[model samples]
Target chain A: MKLETRRVTKRYGDFLALDGASFQTGKDARVVALLGPSGGGKSTLLRVLGGLLLPESGEVVVNDQPLPQEPNEALKTLRKNGFVFQGYNLFPHLSALQNIVLPLCVVHGFSEPEAKERALELLKRLGLEEHFHKRPAELSGGQQQRAAIARALAPKPDLLLLDEPTSALDPVMTGEVLDVIRELAEGGQQIVLATHEISFARKVADWVVFLAKGRVEESCAAEQFFEQPNSALAREYLDGLSRYR
Target chain B: MNHPPTRRLLWSFALMAAVSLGLYITFAAVHYSWNWSSVWGYRSQFIWGWFTTLGISLGAMVVSIMVGFALMIGRRSTCMPLHLLSTGIVEVLRGSPLLVQLLLGYYIVATALHVGDPLVVGTVLLGCFEGAYLAEIFRGAVESIGASQREAARAVGFDTAQTYRYVIIPQAVRRALPGTTGQMVSLIKDSSLLSVIGIEELVQKVRIMNSSSYTALEGYLPLAVAYLVVTIPLSWYARKLERRFAYET
Candidate 1:
């Protein structure tokens, strides 16, 4: 799907989270990684794109349909996309299977048997068949994140938005979750993820947008942006990040 | 199973038995013209009174929970008028004493509305009183759930109502259970306060027996035991529910 934003600005009181941020993705770029500093507009832009957060001003259009300002209408539009939060946010009271089955049956209007079949399939695909009966509290961090991904993908959403999918995990757990995401990228799912892992972005992201202080510093192909960044801010940010790696 | 605190357990049992024996000896020595048979003769009246108390308590409990649910929704609503109205009601009901509210319900409301049934008036007034407190419990329970849970529900395509039905309320109810159970025990005890307004509950029946038989100890002790029978089990059940719903994260 073609996604574009025009001068989108979002503010929380005095702090501007996204200030006149504008960019467009080529139709071929299926996995777009939003690489930025912590307080930058990467998450804000991803939320705006997924219709999770309404921008204070300007436009976010996915396939030419402008995101609505009204909550009900916006929710209707957001139903077309899946969002995986940084915290995983799986239902603690629900088993892994029910987490997927509930959305499929309740929101998407699937029959009980049909929803169960779909949930079982996704759990099996995500290598969580043994954990189908476990609640989120019983699962490890990696298993919970995979269950969250399974819940998001159960409805077959057109677009997926992931906000720092691995920020809460350890290094080994991070690799496990990232591998699932990499597989989804290979499967041609349109995803926009806010991430600090530069190497993982280089491996999977087709397009990269580097943002800092609520503005896009650079937007280019992943190879081009990493190899020869156009702006000084992008170069400095990459340099600072590389030291930590 | 491992050591079992046997000495502590035996000490507690011995102490309880000694206390019971001392209390029984004191009772035997009182000699206040004890007339147990007079109180015992009015067994049917006491039973009817017990049934009335149970009925009112159960009825008021149901109404309070329903009203509490509505008040909770209204309090959390974005609409200013709804929020203000619910807040005002909760404050008014919770701010005043139940006795005054019962008096007002019987004297002003019952007379003004020309309602003759004292039991109905007492039940409704008591319900409103309990509802305000239950509303706070509901609010706290709902707020205790993290905001991310709601966001996750929304991301999964649930609308506001569906989110509450399938996700938010289910978890909130489990969290609220222990608190609600405590309130219910209090409600049963509070139902005795309805006696002043002329509802023939357990305490009122005890008062009648005291006046007729002139035996206060014989009349009041059984009343306290009856309340214990109701409340102790309720508290035990609340503890059970707390353990049952405790999700080990």
Candidate 2:
């Protein structure tokens, strides 16, 4: 599948979160990492890709069909992909198992037993079998994030958008969540992730898109971009990140 | 032999008993003829009145909740006109006095609709009044949920209705429970207002006994006790419910 965004611009009131950003990715780029500083349009671009936010202007075409203008049609097109948020945003009232089962049954029209079976399989696959009945509040941060990923994968969407899935976690917990994501990447799931973990991006992403001040500073193969950044801002960002490490 | 805290507790209990005895002595010194038989003679009327009050409260509670749910949705709807319309209705219902609404319902609305049943009119009027408050409670509860939850639901491919039914409303309902229980208790007390329209609820029966027996104290004392019987347990149940749903959150 190919996804292309042409001159997309999104504004929150007077502030422009995405300013005339444009890029394209083909099936070969299985894992694309949006690497940038905070508030540099990475999250905004990912949200736009996931149809969580509507751009004020521009076109997003997936598989040659433009994202529909109507809300309902846009939602239908968006449902072909899954999104994992940084906060894990699980339904706090529901058990971990029900979190995955509900969307399957309610949105995807799976029967009770069918939804339960799928949910159980995904939870176990994510190594959350013991915490299936625990609510989001009852589970630790790493477990919650894994459960969030499991919920996202339960539907087997064509694409996955992850917005800083490990940013809220500690280093150890971050590694745990990243391991799950790494496994998914190895399994050849088409994914886009917004993250500040430069090392994880270099290790897992095939392509890197460096954004600065809501504009794309550079987009290149991960290794090439890391070895020799195309923009001064990208160089400075990498330098600052390496110094912190 | 006793601990200091236990001795203090005994002293406090003795003081409370002394206060009660002094109050009783003061009442006895008043020399007013006590007409216990007059109030007791209408025991059947009071019981019937109690049930009628309960029935009206329950009926209004159900209708108000349904109407309140609709109003909450409308107020939060994407359509500007629907939101404005629901907001206006809620404000109007809540701004005006319940007494005025009842009078209007009994005189103008019921007559205009050609419905003469006092019970039905009373229920509708009280329901509408309480529904406005309930709508606000529901709105607060729904809005308190973080935006990420809605995003996650939509990300999972659920539409607006499904999001509310499965994700949003369940959490909102849990948060709204304490507030809702308070409104329900108020609703029971507010049903006493229906007596003004000749519904013959408990308060109205008490008023009748007062007029007939000319013993206001005896007539109203039992009425107060009857209301306590309903509200005390209801408030306790609300507390129980709050505890029951207070899961790890």
Q: Compose the digit string of candidate 2's lDDT tens values, residues B44-76.
A: 999999999999999999999998999999999
Whole-model lDDT values for every prediction = 0.90, 0.89
RMSD of 1: 2.3
Model 2, runs deviating above 4 Å: B1-33
lDDT of 2: 0.89
Cα-based TM-score, every candidate: 0.95, 0.93
Which residue pairs in candidate 2 have backbone atoms (N, alpha carbon, C) closer than 3 angstroms, thus clashing?
none
CAPRI grade, predicted model 2 = medium
User: What is the CAPRI rating of model 1's predicted complex?
Assistant: medium
Cα misplacement distance, residue B219 of candidate 1 (Å): 1.1
